[model samples]
Target: MSTSATEPEAADLVCQLDNVQGMVDALTSVRWKRHQDAVVELSEHGIVLIVEESRCLQAKVYLQRELFVRYGYSAQGRPRFGVSLGLFVDCLNTFSVPGHSSTIEIQYPGPDMQLLLKSLDSANACIYAEIRTRIPDMVSWDYNFEPAGSTPLSFTVKSSALKEAIDDLEWPGSSIQITLQPVPPSVTFRGDGHGNLQIDFKYYVNTDLLVAFHCDHQVSYRYKYKFLHATTSNIPASVIKDNRGSKLTIGRGGMLKVQHLVSVARPSISHSHVDSAGYQQPSRIAYIEFFVKPEEDEATGNDS
Candidate 1:
């Protein structure tokens, strides 16, 4: 089996995850298609799964070491390989029971260099799967987002509300325009097609809905509706249930960056540690990021 030049051939990696469904949900967020391939990079910090589409859209899911119950890494360097994303997600789904939470043990680079996963909850009916892996192709996009000028064009909104607005704007428009201005401190989503539709979130009027708004100058950019929807289409239920907020930022050259946090802690259980004063820490969360390129056209009307 071929491996990255920085990594040794015979290294070993094993980890135990208490929240099987959490892993499933996190991975599913990036599974855009039924048979997409993802690049898996394992480091001392944790595992990173990357999936991209047509070089225009890319997403990453960071499974940090702290999220795992036990993370064992003895590799000389970071190891990266390619695996079938659909197969991996399907295999992990088998370990997730509706009402019963189970633990799963994950190991990498089996004798034949296959990803290994097994359910640890049931001894009699243990579920085990071995998926084939291959040498990963070079990732197409690694954009360094330019700063959004001095004001930092950004906003934070409830994930559920953001998802709803994006879904409702899925009409006949091929591109969606996003505008942010500091005058009234608001963000607008506009879809122009046979039937024009617009949704606005005024910071002062709906403080709770539009939690944070920062825009020094008026900036607007158009993006493919499909790409915009992908960022919120597969948002995990856990994110909505926790009432988490999604952050959106527009960098230089109209690059759009969307960030979401998915908790990996077991459900109905506390994964925090208390200090002497009985102050509890926050649950371990997985970080997800998406980068979407803007359309070729310049900003439309009302762009300062």
Candidate 2:
């Protein structure tokens, strides 16, 4: 019989970090400089968080056993138990981040079993699913985090290489999720072949993950969706991505107010359409964005 599976409620503690009143009893792993200690394997059907230490410590949490310890339990008449590692990790990441964190799981699986072994385990601390928490206070002079109030140096979305895309665009940091949707073509303005049609987005760049730099520190900002040479007053509401309640308002059929503008030439994004002859032509655009911010720091040279 698996020991850990006896306590089902403990699964809830998998990915959370909170200041609890006490500690934990199971064997533990301290924060070593390199979180290279483990491998995160994700597949279509499931994901596995593995700890790869060549040498076994006194006690270590394995995928199989961690589920058992966290969700196993027993009762007087019925010895019932629940164990789900997926649910545990889901709850953990829902609350914590890919970065550093700690969590405590309490399992009180009914009566019958003696409390000696379970109660005597570690009670002073919680468990953690951690990664890079050691953000050094200082970056080498060579590195720079964009400071607030500065124009971000624009990059060729093409120049955003595979690795950069994987780091910033694909496997982006936490708490910020950005999505885009296509706006249907219109027939109000003369659209060149290069008219705006699609909206792209980047999240948690300025506020959450990349907060240390000048680009991130700024406070006043709004993002809006817009189309050139158009008045939005009479048009129905325009939706960007799936943000329903959060959308740009049109005063004139072509004009929309930009909200959440951190930095931009224009906050809102929209496309221009041309109606001539029997053909309705809409313009294609690379991408659209605006940068509305305060004066930036001199040292950062924000746009450089």
The model with the greatest TM-score is 1
Query: Can you write out model 1's per-residue Cα lDDT over 1-304, one digit (the tens) per residue?
Result: 3323213235467889988888888998877668888999999999999999888889999999998988888887889999888888988999899878889878887767888777888779888777899999866477888876776789999888999999999985988999998888889999999789999999999887887888889988999999999999888988776657799999988889999888777666364443432222244788899999888865363348
Off by over 4 Å in 2: 1-4, 14-35, 38-149, 154-304
lDDT of 2 by residue, 63-168 (tens): 2222221333322332212223233333343433233223344333222231112222247642332222122222212212232233331111211121122233
- Residues forming the 10-long window of minimal summed lDDT in candidate 1: 1-10
On lDDT, the leading prediction is 1
Residue 137 displacement in candidate 1 (angstroms): 1.7
Candidate 1: stretches off by over 4 Å? 1-11, 269-283, 298-303
Clash statistics: count for each candidate: 0, 65
